[model samples]
Target: MTDYYGILGVDRDTSFDEIKKVYRKLAREFHPDVNPDPKASDKFKEITTAYEILSDPEKRQRYDLGGDPFSQFSGGQNFGFGDIMDAFFGGGGGNRGPRARMRAGQDALIRVELDLAEACFGAERELNLETAVACEKCSGSGCAPGTKPNVCAICKGRGETQQVTRSIIGQVMTSRPCAACQGYGSVISDACNECAGDGRVRSRKSIPIKIPAGVETGNRIQMSGAGEVGPGGGPAGDIYVEIVELPHDFLVRDGNDLHISIVIPMTSAALGTKVSVETLDGSREVAIKSGFISGETIILKDLGMNKLRGHGRGNLIVHVEVTTPNKLNKEQEELLKSLAKSRGESQDDVEIHHRGGAHSSGFFGRFRDAFNR
Candidate 1:
């Protein structure tokens, strides 16, 4: 008195195709290999039994008429193997034609070293690499001159062999790729000597690579159709070029911004002066304001790295370090003392203040803010 329709979550009037579709979904969900629940195995068995009995038109009709269909066989009855194969594997349990020898190739990757200037600005390079290419001797056909492939006699160009065997589920039909043909349906008896029937050969060749600006270390550039050729001279795969940026002599890069430190005389910082610094664009003079403290920054617009996949450029942040006269001569010391006295400062006069607290708007403040920035 098993209600197969109720077990499959379908009404009695449901069509066989609808029943099979539901069974496929339930099977994928409850199959032991996929579902971890212990009860799912028994649930899968119940659903599979429900589908097998309900899928057949005669079984469905007999069950509808209140007759027992399982009474005739002590073991399981016969069902077409294609039904199970199709339900589980998305169809194609029947005869399949030969597979093509040519297929898309795999992607390849390589790393290249670049200098700061080269990375900041786009550049082209010609590099040599060993990769697979169409064989010149065989013209990518894999056959020698004036010779061609022959149809496989074992599978008769079908590329597969089928057999039926009795199992717990009754007769089951199975098919596999033919060993003789290797699924190609044809055999290259007279293969090209240079390529050894693969239709391609490995050789060293030079290819040009164009690197975009602002590419950082570990950034990859993809070149389509620049990889290894396929087995039978099919379309080549893509080539990925990974960048390794070399350290610059003076400039430190952070994203698109560039950083450089420059030392200036204390007098120049106090009195204000323009100092020429070397930038990627060329030598540029940066103006220091009067009373400018050490550790302050000067930003030069459009002087950093060129923007990658974008417009314009970044800024060059110049860090200033004022060099105090450590060993002042007698005249210089006297002059500094006189200037300090004129500015109301003396040897014994002292003012104690915490950094970045109440009084933090002068030389030390600017210096701390510079480093913090």
Candidate 2:
């Protein structure tokens, strides 16, 4: 007699949970999929057979009494981990009954490119795609003209065939999907010619989609029942529109915020000015304060991208860049020199101070001040 407890590395007095734990561990170790050793498959089968008997209360009690449990079965029986799992986890092991011919279609995904402005304000788009749809000729029945499907005669509508075999334990009966019915319990006597008995056909369709405001890249919008129709005219799956944001000429997006850079001449930055700025909505006048330093930022509230699934909008951040006159004429050069002398900036030894009265001073005052802060 083989010691089932020793084979699973568990004691005879071990609890069912402990035995199951050890069995699972050994099963993974000796499984044919994990271990390529030819002998490992036989070892896994032995382990599974032991678990199948020991996990059952009646079978275990009979084994404990020195009775031959294999003698109780007249025909071959299926015993494996799948049986153990089904006993404990409420799952069906082998012979899962007939399979449904019609099933829900799979979800489909399509990429859509949108400009920055369109994404911010929302837009409508027309899309064309090819997908499976229910056949109109037979009304998705998969039957030709006046004929319909008939129950399988071989398996008697059970969708499975059983075979008896002799093994070491006893005679084992194994059931497999019926070849005639293909597990559907029925056979198509006369298949529809239009869809070739699939009950669905590939078709080109034009659909209108409404893109919501504030959708960003990688976001997906789902449209229910807009995808492919399943075989046998099952319910259609959903269609997902994946957003792909295109690069804008002057705008860059960060979350709900919009960022843009504007270049201004040194005079305009120093003396202050108003400039016409082009925004997604329209052109607006932006005020540039006097003495505005390069790299300074100005925020315009409610002028950015729209918020997704919420009210209001984000702010637009404007970065300013000051440009010095590189090709100054002789007159301009002399005027700058005169202005430099007026500010006592002609001499290199002249001391400069930041507006905050910080220790940093001179031409690099702003840089040092930024670091000090």
Candidate 3:
């Protein structure tokens, strides 16, 4: 008698929902799709069957009463020693082998680099990749040219062999893949020279890939049927193209928003001006407002990268840095001093002159002060 709770690694008093959750989690972890381990797949199937039986009130009650629920004439009774398999697989018999060679191949992964703008706006590129493709000369068959496979004598074309043996405890019976044909039910006397016994050959392939807009680093793009070709001409696996972003000179991307910074003359800070700036779309003039404080941000709406998902676009934030004039001449200094006198102020008013002075209020004012000397 198998302990249902022990099989699922759960407490005896665990709730039905908890049992289901644990079973699903473990099943997903050990599923052939993820683990691909034969032993793990069997364990997962066992646990799944246990949960299915125990989670049902009637089935659990019947099992608890020890009524010999498994019937020899029923679907589960003779299902190969009362071992009920999952619906995802075939019946009690082992998987049938091909007359020739047959098996699917593995997928492949390739890394690609994209510029910030190209990644944001989406772009097309050609990829040179190496993978296993079906052998054209043999048409993915392991048999040599103009030849075919022969039935295995061990299993008589059944792909499996059954044996009965007497042990110390009692007599036992088991069925397994035929050794002569390795369960393929057939033997290839002359294998394909190109791919040897297997029906696949290694070769370089050129593929076109389209990267969607707003794709970030480490993102993956999947191409179906682009991976290694399956054995015996079976369906191909998938190809995953991983994205890597290149650092931009003037732009820093954060999700959807774009951050840009540039230095301008000090005079532009005092007086209004329009400076031409480069953006992904093209060059455009951004207004430098009158008395524009250093480090002030100018947000250009709908000018950033297109949203990776959803509608609309992100904002482009421009950070301004005021560049003060250097190498002042005597006449220039004198004119500045005269202008300061006319304005009824001197260099002592430096604190008050800058919008980001110590006495300034508001968030922008403080932010500007933090950015300046």
Report each candidate's C-alpha RMSD, comma-separated, in the order given: 19.4, 18.9, 15.2
Query: Any runs in candidate 2 off by more than 4 Å, and if so which?
Result: 1-95, 168-170, 354-373
> Candidate 1: where is the Cα deviation over 4 Å?
1-97, 162-174, 327-334, 352-373
> What is the C-alpha local distance difference test score of each model?
0.76, 0.74, 0.69
Ranking by lDDT: 1, 2, 3
CA shift at 64, candidate 2, in angstroms? 65
In model 3, the clashing pairs are none
Best of the candidates, TM-score: 2
Put down candidate 2 lDDT per residue, 1-373, tens digits, no spaces.
Answer: 8898788878889898777777767766764323545566578668877886687776788888987655433211222123333332234445476654655667899999999998998988887999888777754557675566688899888888899999999999999999998987878888889998887899997878889999999999976567777776554777799999998878777788887778999999999999877778787799999998877778888999999989999988777778998998999999998998987785668776556633234423543343344
Number of clashes recorded per candidate: 0, 5, 0
Two-way lDDT contest, 2 vs 3, winner: 2
Please identify which of the two predictions, 1 or 2, would achieve the higher lDDT against the true structure: 1
